[model samples]
Target: MSDKELTTKKYWEAYYKNSHVNKQHILTVCSYYSPIWEIFISNSEVSKSLIEIGGFPGRYLAYLANRYNIEPTCLDYNSDLTQIEGSFMEMDVQHYHIIKEDFIKFKPKLKYDYVMSNGFIEHFKNYDDILDLHVKYMSENGRLLVMIPNMKGYIQFYKYLVDYKNLKIHNLKCMKLKVFEDFAERHNLSILHLGYYGGFPLGIHQKINFLQKIIYKLHRLVFKYFANDKLKKYPSKYFSSAIVGVFEKQ
Candidate 1:
């Protein structure tokens, strides 16, 4: 598909026009990232400034800001009707800055300590250029994070085969981890961490069928009761529905 047909201002404006479903999905996804951000804060000095390139109505950043008390900037094409109240869940949305502009052309007076996007890069035909744009505003030694739907992963592939109609509307590319590793190399960045998250058999948000959910529940019972803690945490490449990569600017 052409870049014009891909995710644009109009695309998102329409998507979030009645955004209750989208907000719920964003909250579900952000719950996973919240723990990851805690790990980042524990290891390094607190990140003073962070930005989400395509975040609109900024619920994800609001969740993070509430936990870490960091300054957040949401750069997106336009605003949505879904507003996350400052006091709603005790998040201080006052520090969150929402910028209505094209991320490619956005020039910040100050760089951010952490730059991120959730399901952002895959929208473009030239994703490598998008990655470049994401890293452009990072401070020295800052972290870069990108998360995308795993169209290549086993569980998602199964969905594509059976539930093609539901998946077709997103128009996502089958991006793999190697593409990100290559991007890091070309940009002179160091890969800090890379992994998959959100297993489909357990993650309800994948629109899993009833039979699969029942089987997954039974498996979870066995795994929880019979399996060792280490075995329970075993990584499965094929099961994850999303892939996350974090890189540091060199």
Candidate 2:
């Protein structure tokens, strides 16, 4: 409720007001193999009641509606993105519901069978606290899906070369896994699976082709070694470009 939380309203409004990355790329990656595909489709039966935190423009939610036959209302602090679909409500995530407002001002009263946030929390300086927010809303036996910038992704290296705003952690932190796991445990959520992409093991994204079928297969051979038992055993903050956790609330 202080100035710190208040900034989210303006920050996110600017984000949603701007043009996004090419929608085609989103459809190609997310529509195909990302957790977005798995979470959206697997829980399609409960689509009508789903509530997406940080839902922007309803792109992924719309994917669920179109591809998985689920109707989901998206929520964000921005009013503009909610215009076309009418499936949005303006509410801040940290301090919502103070004066009979939306779910953002206070703890969520509605329990969703599935709660998801993708590429949203990583922007926070304190991602640990950000994730705890989601865990608070998770229904018993519900699933929480999160996709952040992968620390080990091919694109991450490029960020160092070309952009100044790349995730600073790789440049700063020793480990990020413990941070993620701690947040999950504090709320009694268990992570089921985690993956790194471009198809895995060998650097699948290295090939200039980007669509070379052979490289994808070779990367399959690569995934097993890179994400070996030892590394995978450690907290997700220890490795990978981004992480996805399928959490079941206890």
Instruction: Write down the lDDT of every candidate, Cα atoms only.
Output: 0.66, 0.51
The top-ranked prediction according to TM-score is: 1
Residue-level lDDT of model 2, residues 1-250, one tens digit each, is 3332324566556646755434464466456444435643365355334557777655565555455554454556565643325321221111111112233455676766667777666555555666777766666677777665565445345334333233352222212455557767787777665544322223332224444455445544565555445444443432444565666676
Top model number, lDDT: 1
Clashes of each: 0, 17
Candidate 1 regions with alpha-carbon error over 4 angstroms: 1-5, 19-29, 42-47, 81-90, 161-166, 169-174, 201-232
Alpha carbon deviation, residue 218, candidate 1 (Å): 12
Give the per-residue Cα lDDT of candidate 1 at 126: 72
What C-alpha RMSD separates each model from the true structure?
Answer: 4.7, 8.8
lDDT of 1: 0.66
